[model samples]
Target: MKTGKRIKGLMACLLVTTLMIPNVAYGSQPPYSDKAIQRVMGKIYEPTTVDLTGMKVVDQAGAPLNAELKFMLFDTTIQEYSPEVHANNGVLDTTTLIKGHHYILSLADANYEMKNKYFTLDATGELPKDDKTNKNSDSPERESFDSITVTKREQTLTEEELKKVNRIPFCDDNNGAGKFVSELSGTVDMPDMADMYINDYDVKFKLVNQYETVELTVDEFGFLQGDMIEDLNYAVVMETTDPELQNYVLLQDLVTSKNHQEQGENVLTRTYTHYTCNPIGGIYLADSSYEEGQSMIEDCTYAPLPSYSKKSTLDGIRVFIDRGRKINTDMPGALFKVFRDEFVFNERVLEETDEKLVMDFDTINMHRDEICKLPHGDYTITTTLPTENEVQAVYNVDRAGNKVEDCTFTQEGSNLSIETTSVSLYNTVIEFKHVHEFEKIDGTEPTCTTTGVNEHWKCTSCGKLFADEQGENEISLEDTVRPLAPHKYEDGKCVVCGASDPSITDPENPDPENPDPENPDPENPGEGGTSTPGSGNISTPGSGNASTPGAGNVSASKKGATAVPATGDNNPFALWTILAFASIAGIGSVVVTKKRKSN
Candidate 1:
């Protein structure tokens, strides 16, 4: 019997410990103490300051309940047959109520309830309800009790609140007629949306009014296509040239002062942007890592009113291409040249749209050939216009890649044209189309002469030229010249690989020379001293022409040695020395010959 009792006691102790495990294992520790909760418990009775206080306590009789109520509303229930009570009433626990984001108070029973017997208690809940015991039999027509209020807690902004973007993304849609166009009149800024909206919808319309008009807009999918044949002030138009005009123009939000020009006050310039588009919805996601989509924009997308630019030129057409490069793809066959020397374009215009860019080509394809041929060194094709003109083009310089246009060129109002040319695999392009003021500027041959230079003199006049010591002679001191024909480098030849043709190497002139060499020899076998076209130094045999008794002139090749005097009838020893010392007097014995094996 004692063993059985001991076993029962141990089992009871195990059961109690097992039940306590849950309470101790994962329950949350309240950040505040019960005393902290009691400090602000007098809020339920003061109707005036009800919402002002964060937490409150109340009694069963609607009085200021004692702060020492160490209980919480664990659950709620609804009692209804004909007249239904709140779903939360007697329907859930404190955990579920906190989870659902709201709190409700209700009575436990209907007939057993008194008047105002609905309010319950949770973590600071009030007790507006009194039990049937509190209600006397004379209490006429008992009324049900229920109420709901904010839980007095902080929360994160909802999706809708974040979408508001602090009202920054909203248009001045007062009554909604001219909302998008009215309030915005500035530059560009880009900010990420906290949330996205209707990404799959498209808008198709032809809105027209006094300020703006959409000729024809057909957006059916995720693509954008619209033609706004709008009349804009030249200055205003310039300020909104970027494709993301809406985003960019937000930069204007920072301006505090501006002289608002009345509409139609000035007659300056015009802008026309046509939109021809083919909707292509799904974008090429980076994670996809597939070579998808059309190779070119034209193939996959359509733009009836494709974007373009009217880049500013000094009043007339100005050329801006080198020997074989072209401008603007807009006019594949057209080129640019400046009529006026320099000017500044309107910054606002470029910020608004790139259509005004005169350079028909994106900076990426300013030239048809690969830029790798002439890695982005300081090579520019420029011409002086009638006036002083300057331009700054911001662009992307990808290695072995063409430049990507990224900025607008601002210039003053003047007639200027930039020169451009178009070329391809077969048919070459050599035409001039003007920017700013569209007047054709003819391209004359580079009015300078190109003479061939070996190692010596430059031929200002047309003739064979060399840049070596043996100037324009038929022979070259260094046998090496000319590239390996077509398969060669851009700036002459590859020094390391010895890969080039004669066009890059001028064995007779301007040969490559080494400076601060480890071994300084006038005749360096290294590529550093390979003879170019215009190295200016040559050697020649002496002149042996002279009358009797008059010595012929000659210079010795070895430094510090005097020239040999010709032996004639005047000097008897000269002849005898040659015969008597015949063993040592070999022909041309004054100098030692240098021998080298060829590579």
Candidate 2:
């Protein structure tokens, strides 16, 4: 048994060992140990100093460099210290770096103008890969060190140096760093005279490099003054946000003056005055690409740039007046007027001699003329006819020659040509006609009604009223009648009309000698029968004088006789009281029987 126990213990030990073997083999190795170094050799390694020799320096063209260029060596492991070294004759021979550690080789002076380069040393003779140069194997190496070649960096010019070489001119002696004035002068020419003036517009100048913009309003002399940078190029843009000028095309130009002095002072001045032609006008006959109809003034000068022009031809419009055939008499004298933008062109009276009025309307071509020509804008034509009178009614004719009732003169703008259809005149004749006149015929005075009619005068000539025929205009005289009040009956008599209700009977006057005792009459009590408590010959439950428990009885036996009240027979709960008493007695008997049997 002891041996068996020992064997069992041995088996348990073996099982535990087997379970721990995998964990021990796969566990993490100690930090910085040989096994740890082997595990992380490629990914991480200890930093140690290694010797570097026979390094050479050259230019980008592969020529050897002879100047003494100072460089810095940085140990990535201990980044705080960066030792300086000097390279001469394109060689650096005395530098010790770490194997498996990263190192940076950079020019010691920022003015050296070269980017820094990094290298990692490995004792296994593996070269580090460069992101730009990759791995180069063209150089011979020493027994204890590696050789590398570095190139000289390109130099960058300073700001002042750049300006000197480029020969950029400035407005001021201090490299154009002062306030300067900019003057803009120009003349605008339009095809048609407009209310717009030179002072109504503005010019904007923006310096591209400085990110500055300023707006200058034009003066009455067609000149604007503002501040600008002397050494910078400007983008001169002329525009207007006014609602009246939004239709005009905007002008823009890039202006740069290499000659600081144009004619005199240091002021940068330019002249650009060109009108933006309005393109709204009549149809054009020329090619759409050419602007033909409108011409600019000789004095108007632009920035010697391409500009847009508008050309158009003026077309004639006609106006016609006619007297409607519907009028039996001559047409009334009427005034006709034509206006364009508050400018009246024609105003005349329409008479028998002057049948129609003809006027010329101008239409401009948009392609040729930059703007719409005069007399082509909004036009309003108004006609005034005679007012309606008792004898005749006057009206205006529509486009289809239909007579318009109550037509009045309108002053709204329209593009349609004036042409009257027909005017009609009728004779004034008085005629009597029947018209509705509401007369109250039923209610009180001043009541409204629609049942009565009165005679009203109507004109057969122009449908006008001159007189009203007299009619019954007072309240209705039929009657002030109402429905009878509903009847109410009480005790066989109506309470409202004092009439007898034959359907209702009086209990007090019921059939004599056969009257109902339940409804006894107060005045004649003996006629029905008095309901005295002990006098009625009715049998009541538990009315005898026998003394018994559980019996519902109340006796009046002062004279040795049990007299039960007749009202006891009318007790509503008499049956219920008797049943309760019997139930108690039966339960008591049942209990006694059960107890006796148990004993």
Model 2: residues with Cα > 4 Å off, grouped in runs: 1-47, 123-599
> What are the lDDT scores of the predictions, listed in order?
0.23, 0.33
* Model 1 per-residue lDDT tens digits across residues 313-429: 112111222111111222221111111111112111112121212222211111110110111111122222233333334333232335432333233433332332210101111
* Candidate 1 TM-score, true structure as reference: 0.15
Best by lDDT: 2
What are the per-residue Cα lDDT tens digits for candidate 2 across 134-199?
A: 322111241222334454335655655433321223223223332122211121111122122334
* Cα error, candidate 2, residue 273 (Å): 61
Residue 596 of model 2: what lDDT?
Answer: 100
What are the models' TM-scores?
A: 0.15, 0.18
